[model samples]
Target chain A: MPTAQGGTLYRGREGMWSWVAHRVTGFAIFFFLLVHVTDTALVRVSPEAYNAVIGTYQTPLMGLGEAGLVAAIVFHAFNGIRIILVDFLAKGPRYQRVMLWIVLGLFVVTMAGFLPRHLMNVFGGQ
Target chain B: MTNATHGTPAVAERVGTLDAPRSPYVRKKTTRGNYELYSWVFMRASGVVLVVLVFGHLFVNLMVGDGVEAIDFAFVGGKWTNPFWQVWDLLMLWLAMIHGTNGLRTIINDYAERDVTRGVLKGLLYLAFTIVVVLGTLVIFTFEPCPAGADPELLASFCTA
Candidate 1:
């Protein structure tokens, strides 16, 4: 018997999350890249001006902003890799889920390694 | 020729109840080669690696060296001057763009109803990928730490006048 909506619970094409994640990450990376380009472009203006631009980034707010940038790039790259695999290789649906979890686990691990170094530089004054 | 199937011999299988089980709504076909299995492995593997590579890139660029304050002409110039950072940035760029494009390709195939639409969308996607990846790679490799005959103060703090 069908559900209230009269459709099977999870009957549809393959790799739903992979598609969604790719789009979400793509937009996110685009936004981050725009900001990055604009900021980097400041260096071309003048030395002191570039210095001034860079100086503003030292604030805690900027650090937090960067934290987000890191996350966005990571998700986009990893999920994008997943989509690439699906399109070119034709992997299994069950295996895709397994790999996604692996990506998540690695994300956490890498963040653990990097965040400390960043926080040390930021808050600890290292 | 016969009325239907014209000279085609219709040989009914001798075995009874021999068909493989399948879901009612699901299409049944013999599974393809192990290539798909490998693709599954690549996604997870690349995904795991990307998380590290991409995040490391962001942290270094945006957060390191006096946080964002240290970032400037000198900042990027200094970073890219080192082959190590250059490689890092390059990896991040290549990986993310390819990944994103592949993801979008899947979406196009799943959503687009007509073959023509799918082909057009994929063509556009590939074009965009080419432009971004090429531009980004060039910037990373060819960037000059200092432009000739440029104002010093306007340049990065580290650049010699």
Candidate 2:
């Protein structure tokens, strides 16, 4: 809960929420990485084997999952840069709130550009 | 002024030398090296590189041409056949695995209140990290774009009949 030592500063603020999101997204990505590596490894088995597995990823359900995965990656990447700035920049702590907003803005723009094109590929009946 | 003048306090201050210790006990030297420090630095460093590598990967695999629909055995075969992509994937695999492992280690250290729980979680984490990295690495290096018996339709376009 908020009773923890470091929670005093981060509790009930953008700092705390962003930190939470980072951890959640990171855990998701790490597990996905394990599965991804295993799937890619199917290439060594045979072309048919690889395609058989990857074909599942092209389904509408998995397309939505891929979108979520990409969204997690985008947010994590931007917020990670924000964290580095907070750690290293002279004015980092002072501007961390503003930086979080910027991170969100970039996340929105990136996903906006990505989703339409990606959805088309997924559901465009090609 | 009176407290300063009062007692043995001023005497001890004057008598104590900077070069000598008041107690005979010696502090033990730290055997714990800067492993955590290096891990911290690696997360940040690898993070920056991963942003580039992962974005490029997604862009190529998902956002280009046919997008996710374009991905399959032939798609993967075509990309891995290129030395540039081979190196790219290899670096991404190792860096991402290590970075994620270290991050999870920090998380386990934070949340796993019990020593036994922490140790068990980290043991599994490292095991998974090793298997994935090894599997991914071998896949990238040993991938055959065109196997003799594979369906030609499944192989990359450039693969000769």
Q: What DockQ do the predictions score, one after another? A: 0.21, 0.66
Q: By lDDT, who's the top model here?
A: 2
Docking class of 2: medium
What are the per-residue Cα lDDT tens digits for candidate 1 across B4-99? 366544343323535566735655675786855665565556566766786576666645665544455666777877899888778867766665
As a whole number from 0 to 100, the lDDT of residue B61 in candidate 2 is: 93
Query: Which candidate gets the maximum DockQ versus the true structure?
Result: 2
**iRMS of every model, one decimal?**
5.9, 1.5
For residue B123, model 2's alpha carbon misses the true position, in angstroms, by: 0.7
Cα lDDT listed for each candidate: 0.64, 0.91
**CA deviation > 4 Å runs, candidate 2:** A1-10, B1-29
lDDT of 1 by residue, A78-98 (tens): 656655555556564547777
Evaluated at residue B158, the lDDT of candidate 1 is: 63
Which 10 consecutive positions of candidate 1 chain B have the poorest summed lDDT? B8-17
